[model samples]
Target: MMSSTFLVMRERVVAAIMSNPVVGPDSAGTLARMNDPSQNCTFEELGFDSLARMEFCIFLETEFGISLSSGEIEASPSINAMAAYLAGEG
Candidate 1:
């Protein structure tokens, strides 16, 4: 089972993905699938191109007060990876 903290973080990431007009609701599922730390589904698999990743960084900054460096995002290419990065676990 995933930790509650990770689940909470996942929900936040899902909400961020769903709220973005540029991303559809289906994107949330893709985000969720890619969020697994064990999976290598990657941001690219969830349709997060470079521009989308930048926008996601902005969203994370605005929503979670987490400012991710470009290198951080590049290294952690999934929602859980990003969450871990933001939570100082990466």
Candidate 2:
């Protein structure tokens, strides 16, 4: 089971992605991106790409006040999985 806090973070992450013009408000499109084998999602697919990865970390830190490793973030491919990981349930 995931902690309520982590669940909230996942919601925030989804909101963040949706805020991106490229992503927009289409839940289906975001889900497709998550399921794309070529992208393989992970955290790296959060549009981090190396340079942006650090920025993403910073964003998470500033937004959620939680310090997460790139590897930790990358290990989770789906929002639910990420939430579970963040919640320390996985």
Candidate 3:
């Protein structure tokens, strides 16, 4: 079962993605799909490229007050994956 903390983190990740100016408006549907726990879509499919991915990593770091290695960012490329990584389950 998924922990409540992880679930909340997932929601926060989705919210962050939605608020990102660079990739938000264009991928609103993808962001909405991220709310589904079963979804595991990649950033590329959601219209995010390397620069957008880096920007998102920066956003997550600032929002969570945590530093993320490039490997960590690459490893957690989806909303659920990112939530797991943030929750220390990655």
**lDDT to native, each model:** 0.63, 0.56, 0.73
Output the better candidate (1/2) by lDDT. Answer: 1
The pairs that clash in candidate 2 are: none
Error (Å) of candidate 1 at residue 40 is: 7.5
Model 3: colliding residue pairs: none
What are the RMSDs of all candidates, in order? Answer: 3.5, 5.6, 2.2
lDDT of 3 at 10: 82
Candidate no. 2 TM-score: 0.56
Candidate 3 residue-wise lDDT, 1-90, digit = tens: 999888888877776677666776345566557768766656656777667776777777788776776567678887788888888777
Q: If both were scored by TM-score, which would come out higher, candidate 2 or candidate 3?
A: 3
Top TM-score hit: 3
Clashing pairs in model 1, backbone N/Cα/C closer than 3 A: none
TM per candidate: 0.65, 0.56, 0.77
| Top candidate, metric lDDT | 3
The 10 consecutive residues of candidate 3 with the worst lDDT sum are: 24-33
Instruction: Please identify model 1 stretches exceeding 4 Å from their true place.
Output: 21-41
